[model samples]
Target: MLASTTTTTQISSPPQQKFSLWSPPNPSTFYCSSQLLSKPNKHSQKLQYTERILDQATNILSVLYPTSTKTFSNKPLASLKTFIRDFLKKSKTTFSTLQLALLYLVNLKKSFQNLSFLQENIQLLSDPIFKCGRRMFLASLVIASKVVLEPAPKNIAWSKLSGLPITEINNAERLLLSALNYRVVLPFEEFVEWNILLHSPTVELFQKINLVLKKEIWEGKSNEEDGPHYFVHYQGWKEKWDEWVPESRGLKMTEENLKKQKDLVAAHTTKKPEKKSEATAPSSERGKKRKSEHVDTVDEFAKRVEIKIPIPEELKIKLVDDWETVTKNQRLVSLPRDPTVTQILQKYREHIINNPTSFNEKEGLKSSVFQEEIVEQVTDGLKLYFDKALGNILLYRFERFQYVQLKEKLNNENNGSNNGTEKLGEATHAEKCMSDYYGAEHLLRLFVQLPSLIAHTNMETDAVNVLKDHFALFLQWMVENADELFLKEYEHASAQYLVDAKNCTS
Candidate 1:
């Protein structure tokens, strides 16, 4: 955390506070500015302004980066700009993430001069042709977003946005982390310095022209340290937009300038004239038509799907409970379970055998839902479905890291076994599939999205209805055995695990 201070007080020893990886120092803490404290904080507007500035900066970079490219040829700047803009739009990246990204890029550039600083092999970055330019900056932005955002954008999302494979994105992130020696935290002084260096007044600032200065910050890098940076606030704007402006910017708050700024602000804030309201009868008729059209749209969507699974209220409560434990409480199901999905299906099959009357068995021997052979066939199909969909859609955001790690581990083990290097007592490579590693917790997630998935398939209506019935019955069976099937409690992921996942090193 940054040290706090008063405007007139002498610098004294502040309480020692340990830096937290999850929580960065607030911009407010780095300043002693108290002016315009009464203005209502508009965080949403501030975030929008920050995004606009960053977007403009990238556009500026596009113009400045490559001057030598042939007029008819493709430019790297266009690709870089598109990649950055898409990620920002799709991910809805926060202001803090963007700011930290700039800081990370600067630090990475500094490290490029000293190759000895990096521990891991970063040949991809060290190539003379690559230079610490567009690619490195993009990588730094990805790394910063991962570090600063909770439930960060998944590797798959990053891959799609960057037009790279998931493995490549992961590799880039890992290399960038090593380049910075994992020092992702930005120092308070560095932040202040950068703000002062790149600070510029756009139309947003001029239109919000109520100015206030709080405290003076000495420019530390200079020999004389004579130039001071002050936190400049637009009285009507958010405190977040109140940034450190250096003396070098030569911004004057004289009376005439203030009056001119106010005039501009008035002009910008002026409202457009509204058209006259329509007659009440026409307006009411139009509203009814819109409502009818909305209903028709929903009906059309419903008609496209052949099946609808009705979730029981008790099941809904269970889902809510599960979400509470997994997401809100930061708890996760342990992996490589004793009673895996395959094992659970086997148990359910056995249960049908032990209690024949419990399941919905048809009266005729010609066609029975729970016939031994039919049950076996259904369970086999279910196991295959679970394996296919788990990595793609069944996982929660927090579970994604573990899922990837577990998958790679299983693949390695299977490969080793195939190479005749497996331990005598360990499970064979054939049994190490996802169905044998993940159990009810993961399987339950599949059921939630299964309806929509099944709807999209080209199955006959009869087959879909039959499959839907089987799914419903299976879920009911699982519910009955919830005590043994469901995870009652989950362990919290360790700090190291989270760090590794965030850094894409796991």
Candidate 2:
């Protein structure tokens, strides 16, 4: 096998963007807050206004978007006016002055009934990745309208209104979602918050906020309008909109491309210039050489590779309590594009743990039946069975481990996460998600789930017994509750062989 000399290097560094909304407006700008220090009357106007302002001003705007980052860069009012002009010239989305003013009052309630308990609180956005601006607000409006409106306009329709391409619009939506790492989801509370932000203010004759984009005049698409209009409304008007995406998302010539790639890989992995004389030899005679050449070529890019060692029929390796055959198959794998093999492994693992594929139900239970075994009372025979069982389990589990670790790393390289922000040719293929499969917290929970299957390789003793018991019950539940294709089949196959390690059932 050829040596693995794969290497990669990172050549660029850029400053990161910090999350920010709009800075506060006036010195006496009353920011809302749900003061936790002192108990406040639930029905008071202070509570409503405080929660409303903070909810919007803060990055956790669940009333609008479920996942919003913490940012101080809010200009929704100005953006709102701009948006209304461009899209809702005749639509009912425009709000009247009285209605809008009432909304401001609700959003900015003066402390009444409990003036002594008034507290100044602000939760500035702290995410280091989210940068909210006009584009973000416009995107939010398009998304939130789907939640609030009975019949929302299609995405493409908003493209003309917002002066953005559908792809750009979708990219903006995706960016907002990814940045909103930590968010608050108070359904009922958010309802009240949104109400107050609109027109449910407890105060009367309050001044309406001038919903103007700072440093910008209205560029709304309108032909009929009076001078200095305060309100904009949308009548019941609809237009035909097409939602067709550009060409095919995937290349139609995949088979041809795949074959070419495989051939290239074969050539690279087997580059030893074996004499041409052997090419004329019988196929059986050249099999070993071809296999060796293939391994040699791929080894250049592989971190590790496993090949099963052929065992003679007369010689069997197993434990005294085992009854199986076929043994010793393992190896390693990595990539040449990363700076180090370790970095490649990390990326591979991330792809596998994150990318989920649909498993076929028929394949799930194909290996459920026990492997054929020879019943031999001799001590050596039992020992051979044990070794074989262990080897089979280890080989099967390791193979699965490799696949699950590098699953999505196999995707076409063109589809990357840095969609909207990429410069002319500065494309990137970055990890888009990191989900903790913890489904757990605290020390006790860690002990409960026991992490992935790799952790149970040499497991035994009381802990092993506990895991077996848990496994049996869980397996029973799965065979009862889970869809056939949903459960990971490899895990089950490995577990069955491990259970047969003692050959008790055999």
Candidate 3:
């Protein structure tokens, strides 16, 4: 069923004024509407900033390691922080503190001519990336451990000084290893160590016991005809070092080796599927067939469902009033009747459990039937409410839970659909059907739920598109509108669950 709405007048803002610290002018501040704020703009900005930092670090490394052939650059690296101020300025976004601290660390590293001297002193405090100080040190150690003599020094005491559980440090070590692509040689540390070793032990030993050891090199002099050895001990070390560290042997680059590396990288990298031309009969025909299939499926389902579910008018009006009251006070609205909602939701769960679909028997039986049922019931009920225009306002508050759950289910199925041809196609079709059906259903649900009428709105298309375009926005709205006190408790419990998972995994 198509969920359509009538629009109303747009909410106008006051005239612009000079910017001030107290009233900072930004889109995030001016458009406090949850609908407007739900767009991926903020998230895109955050990703962009992360890419920029990585790019900057890559450039710094390239400068330091000019001889290295490896390159580290991504296309979207520079566009990472355009609208970041909007989100970072808000105190509610806890990641801002973590982002700032990370930036500070990066800046400190860039300032140093050589990071080796400052390596031991570096420590991160409850940073989001590391999560704790021990994690931070462990991540650094994963890079620098080879250079330092007492890598995990007892005197440093990670547990006591960092105040982190030993388990978290271990987990962080694994994460860092994965992030660095398991390249144990960490070129930066290797280079730093090579420099130190060359100056102290290698050079001094060669000079002291020289048998025909180029005395002119120590006298701060050089001859043009002295050949390659006069420049540096490149050949001598290249020969000796290979024997000393067999793992580092045969490291010379050649045309064949270069081609092999390129081929391997190309094979591993994901290639975008070729898009079919609009004129192609197969692509056009498939689109038409899909549309007809959806229409037929929906029509048949509607016809079978002869009973019209009765919605409580009093409940609808109460929800509308509650939504308005909460929005006015800049607070999230609680579920009107939590026990009643929960009970109705539970009933729907039973319906799904008792009624078996072929796919459900194989897939649903493997998962938490209770959780699956809860999600299905919640989604179906919300769709019903939206189709009837019973209570658009309150319904928006719970919309996100449905979107997240559906997306997660689709992702899980996609990952596990490789068993057989019949199962594979069925899984793929099921994922697509669920995604598109729920997406459209949820969009229509939001259209009916908005406080303002959609009919006469100035930005009618924009408003409609807002509901249709982004599911993430709906999730954000649900979190914002849901009861804050309950949400805080839920989040705390959730965080604890994550911490417990980390502990178990460790």
Candidate 4:
């Protein structure tokens, strides 16, 4: 659903408060004015710096590496521990930690960049950075807190390393929660898992291709007309460059792999019988049969048959109804039938006759049945009339009449009822009946309207609600039968037009 555009007023915080902490200043305002401003290309430059670090690590790994075999003489368990410890010390970071930090920073930076763009265009302030930064510190600490809890122990603790006061940290954490709208779980791993399950080589290949395309864009080697790059460049060595070769070469490679696999399978499986049986056939029939069999085999080999199941009639109708309901709810149809139009008009006329104080000659002009000459004269004579006086008069009159009718019905029901429960049940049944009657009447009225007689009416709120209900049913019917109806109308119109054109020419 589209977000509602209704504006709501929020009570301002008291003046004694230190800051309107909820309304954080825009990040662009801070980032543009900060020390980071010195490096206009900080994002791309940072990526480059990270890439260099990764390259150095990869180079170290390529060298003589201590493994389980080297660490212990045939002691598999001890050697495995030693291998892991040696690997971590040599790499300068645990693989898991490194992966987590890189993924987190990459995703965070992308999100912040998007937020910055939105802030720039819309001029909306984001959740305060003190909130986000503090949250990040807290989250990192939460993960580390599980392992390290000594008062003054080990490597830099989160609070001390963050350089923020405990109160500020707490406040920042709160801000982060608000900024994120309270969603703390990240779905990076889930996204990868889903991608793997999709099992579409095209999607994976496209991702690799997108990475290279983005790199080309970053290096200023991309064609302007090619279009915007969708992928972000990673701060590491490229992978799958060979697979992204030109389409013709790629297809050739794919075909070659398929042929090799086919050959391998063929080597294992026995061939089918090449000849047909000739038990009861004559010499001439045998020659003809062999030719026919050859043709049949060729036809079968050439055919590319695919099986398709037809959708059931009931399911098709249901799908159409659901689609139409959604579309009608979005107000993508014509003006809905409103039974309240006549009701409201009648009530307004009644009010004008009864309430002399509220009604004047000008208000009487609003009656649709009034003569144009009389309406003009009344409007000319009356002074206190507004443009929307007709609408307001109708609404007030209808509401007044509705209240009176409801009161009368309640009074009658109260006299008949022995208990509240019986009265409530009767009222509910009456309401349901009234709703059904109104819906049916509206539908009947809609179906009877000729195209030439179609008219627009300003419906009251209650009338609009009722009309929407009937409109919903009509939309459901249209969804189920619109295709058949449209085709019939189209053919009829075409034939009629052709006949008319011929008659005119003759």
Per TM-score, the best of the predicted structures is 1
Off by over 4 Å in 1: 1-305, 361-366, 419-431
lDDT of 4: 0.29
TM per prediction: 0.40, 0.20, 0.19, 0.20
Model 2, residue 444: what's the lDDT? 15
TM-score of 1: 0.40
Q: After superposition, how far is residue 46 of candidate 4 from its true place, in Å?
A: 26
Candidate 3 lDDT tens digits, 1-506: 11112211121232332110011100111111233223345334333333333233222222221222121121122211221222222211222122222322232333333355235334431234433222333344323332222222321243334444445444554444443334433222222222222222222323322323344223442445432221122221331222111212322222244467669879977676767766677876898996664444323212211111222343334334544443343233222223233233344455445554633454443233324533453344333333223211223332333333444665566655644343211334433323133222123234333322221112224323332222232233333334421222111124443344323310
lDDT of 4 by residue, 1-506 (tens): 11122211121222431211111110110111012113235334323323332332222121111121221222332322223333333323322233333233233333444646456533222434322322343333333222222221212233344334445444433443343433333332232222221222332323443443344223333565544322222222242221223322332113245577568779867666555657535755888996664344333222222112233354345434433332233211111213232332233334334543333353342333233332222222111111111111211111223323444565466545544454221334333212211222222222222110111111134333323332332344344544432221101124543344223310
Give the residue spans of candidate 3 off by over 4 A. Answer: 1-37, 48-136, 139-325, 328-341, 358-506
**What ordering of candidates by lDDT runs from best to worst?**
1, 3, 4, 2
lDDT for 128 (candidate 3): 49
* RMSD (Å) per prediction: 21.6, 30.2, 29.6, 28.8
Write model 1 residue lDDT over 1-506, tens digit each, in one string. 11121111111222332211112212211110111112224343233333444444453233222223332113343444344544565556544565667666545545545547444456655643234245555566677666555456666676666565565556656666766667775553344333322323432222221121111122245444544543344533543464555566543432345567779989998977655776566867997996664344333222323456765566666776766676567677887776899899999878765666745444232235556765675676566556655654455555667877887787677767677565222336364778888888777765665553444233445555556666777787877787888776788889887776455421
Q: What is the C-alpha lDDT profile of model 2 across 1-506, one tens digit per residue? A: 11122211111221221100101011101111111112334234323332333223321121112223332233233333233333333222312211222232222222211234223212212322123344545545544444334455555665656655666665554443333321211132222223333321211111122232211112344234422221211211221221212213222222244467568879868856566786547864688886654343223212211112222222121110011211122222222111222232233234323331312132232221111110011111212222222211222222333333333442223244543454211224352211111100111111121221112122223333333333332233223332321211112234653444323211
**Global Cα lDDT for candidate 1:** 0.52
lDDT of each: 0.52, 0.28, 0.31, 0.29
The stretch of ten residues in a row with the least summed lDDT in candidate 4 is: 25-34
> Over 4 Å off in model 2, which ranges?
1-86, 90-132, 181-186, 197-506
RMSD of 4: 28.8
What lDDT does candidate 1 reach at residue 76?
A: 43
- Scored by lDDT, model 3 comes in at 0.31
Error of 1 at 123 (Å): 43
